[model samples]
Target: MSGSDGSGPAGRDHPFDAAVALKPADTGDGTYTGATHPAYANMVGPYGGITAATLLEAVQCHPERLGVPVSLTVNYAGPVADGEFTVSARPSRTNRSTQHWSLELTQDGRVITTATAVYAARRDTWADTEATMPDVPEPEAVPVTPMPDEVQWAKNYEMRFLDGALPALEGAPESPDSTTMLWVRDAPARPLDFPALASLCDVFYPRVFLRRGQAMPAGTISLTVYFHADEAVLADHGTRPVLARARSNRFGRSYFDQSACLWGTGGELLATTHQLVYFKG
Candidate 1:
């Protein structure tokens, strides 16, 4: 029964919303500035308009707390360059357990991106589900690997893939559709807040999706994350490889489908996700 306001969704609860926008084009190297959009401070990445999940994360992705994402949507029509830009978020709906929101990205007076997201408290019923995480290699056992040029954020976390783009692996088959399996954790143990937790998902934009020989940096227009009940128990699990799986429903020049999952290495199901991505030229 929750919905949006006429202008932008009015905040019914929470104070995590932010505003960002881009500044005048700089001739220094034809790059974007953060002065125009401070919300997008990660100058190294595509930084597509902040996704819907971010809006929700601002309110819910706190570590050492209890929260879950039901859905996240992002409509990216413009790019937030290195230049300064502005972004804002507001709640459109909030029920007993669920909350919804809308956000925007702008540059030099022009609107380029929009998004919506939903969050909910993890429920007790989910604990009974049987989604299991497959056994995997320990983080310490694997050699340290360099982060991908485009996936610079990965440097902060340790990762291992249960099912990567290897040409051959038992049961690990290839597909034209995009998908992937990986494990990630921040070194030195950062606070597991919603923003930090969501940052893990951030490294997994649609562009990073790969299947068989299919791999690309997927910039999502929309993203939806579903907490699989036991996510709160992630700490009980070690830094071992967790179960992760992703898939794409569609892929196009301007649009695509994406999703992912996170679970305990012991086969305990934790969370699953889906996202819609919009690419830039």
Candidate 2:
């Protein structure tokens, strides 16, 4: 019997893998088919981070893919139903040191998501990190916060907040600012990689909800991530938890923008991400 998590009974696929599962069939036109997994389901749709990672996965799986992904941007045009979808990935431009790709995810002939990516061949060069990791207790020192059921995606990872948390709905006042720091990684200890890191970037709860002490309808409209480390750097960290810092600069007119950074335990910067979110008060 099939399970709601999109795997057969006795599910063995890792949650991270299941969340990004995509199959390549003979699409004659070089497109691939994908489906949303229940393991990463949100209140109304698949987590935006998972959807973004899946689109990047399509570009990664394309036979013509060049180099390693350096940057990715995903646009959510509409809701993605819990079923099969199609992804089309094509190389838009290629250069000696850089490559560009364009991609789309569609269901029922309706375009629901779009993305663009840039990949680059790495070469030895001068490097520096300007952003310092937050001075907080190590992951092992912090206790895992209880996961609430409504946000199904929260169960897939272990999150220990060092700074910000959702305010109580009953009598708590609004938060001082929309800033948060947390350590997060896959629950069952999956290796850190591009797709996994991509999903982690969006794992933070909507900043508005955290700041206002209210549950409002909120969703990410677009997200962009810039990778600062290579595969070797990520592999060195294994399944170790990464520290994340997210903050919103402005919230107005039904939209807000968020900026975040992910850091390896060794003080290495992994990636920086930004997003624009839509919210209804």
Candidate 3:
């Protein structure tokens, strides 16, 4: 797998895989251990998306996992320190067709993250999508947005903005509303998977940044993702870039809510996510 600094065998394993890799710990308590990958590091910690993926990975790797993920909610309780952390996942309840999981990530005995996940055996059922994908130019038509060198995690994805790109760091006019529409895929072109989809749900730059027209201190307090695509749908999407749109509903008291949708190349609604973010001037 590609290691930090982007040095590793090409086409062997993508950086996204390395970032979310977990090892089974010998504790025999169904726990896994993982370290932060420098390639995904943020200013104060590893990227929240990668952390969320790692937590979900723990459950996905579990021997007793019931079915594919239907929903996931991750709460960032505290900053994860830059070293090894342990994660544990347990099924709180299991029904004939669905299972509920509780997960936690800890560093030095301190709980840094907590999550809940729902997995279910899907069956054929009537379905309809009330939400429609927005009309936008194809990914080939949009130019790739250059990521800032310092933003390590941003480098992991190829982003092409259709609108609401980040504003200049200085003297940029504020936007009337926070909305970003883009096409994004893993930089090295990994296949679309649940963990990858979970990470992409967070690919949008904080809504506050787009609204204020400048960078600010902000972090996700909680994020929830609803998976609409099944394994077959994701596999069919392959490495194609996904159309994503994110916008904020309100911003006040140093907090904002962001909601987003990810659509497959075939116009299938792959996932929808909502997050609460905390920010500081």
Every candidate's lDDT: 0.50, 0.87, 0.91
lDDT tens digits, residue span 1-281, model 3: 66788876653378888878889888766699999999898878988899989988988889889889999999999998988999998889999999999999999999999999999999999999877888888899999997778889999999999989877778888999899999999997988889999999999888888788889999999999999999999889999999999999999998999999999977899999999999997
Candidate 2: tens digits of C-alpha lDDT, residues 1-281: 77687765432368767767777868655488888888889988899989988988887777877788899999999999998999888889999999999889999989999999999999988978899897889899998885577778888889988878655655767886999889999887788889888998998889998788777899999999999979899889888999999999999999999999999998899999999999999
* Clash pairs, model 2 backbone: none
Residue 210 of model 1, lDDT score: 43
Candidate 1 achieves a global lDDT of 0.50
After the best TM-score superposition of candidate 2, give how far the Cα of residue 223 lies from its true spot, in angstroms: 0.2
Clashes of each: 45, 0, 0
**Model with the higher TM-score, candidate 1 or 3:** 3
Candidate 3 lowest-lDDT run of ten = 3-12
Instruction: Order the candidates by lDDT, highest first.
Output: 3, 2, 1
- Give the CA lDDT, 0 to 100, for residue 165 in model 3: 85
Q: Which portions of model 1 show Cα errors greater than 4 Å?
A: 1-54, 60-69, 121-123, 149-151, 165-179, 205-218, 229-242, 249-255, 278-281
Q: Which stretches of model 2 miss by more than 4 angstroms?
A: 1-12
Worst 10 residues of 1 by lDDT: 12-21
Q: Top TM-score: which candidate number?
A: 3
Candidate 1 to native Cα RMSD, angstroms = 11.0
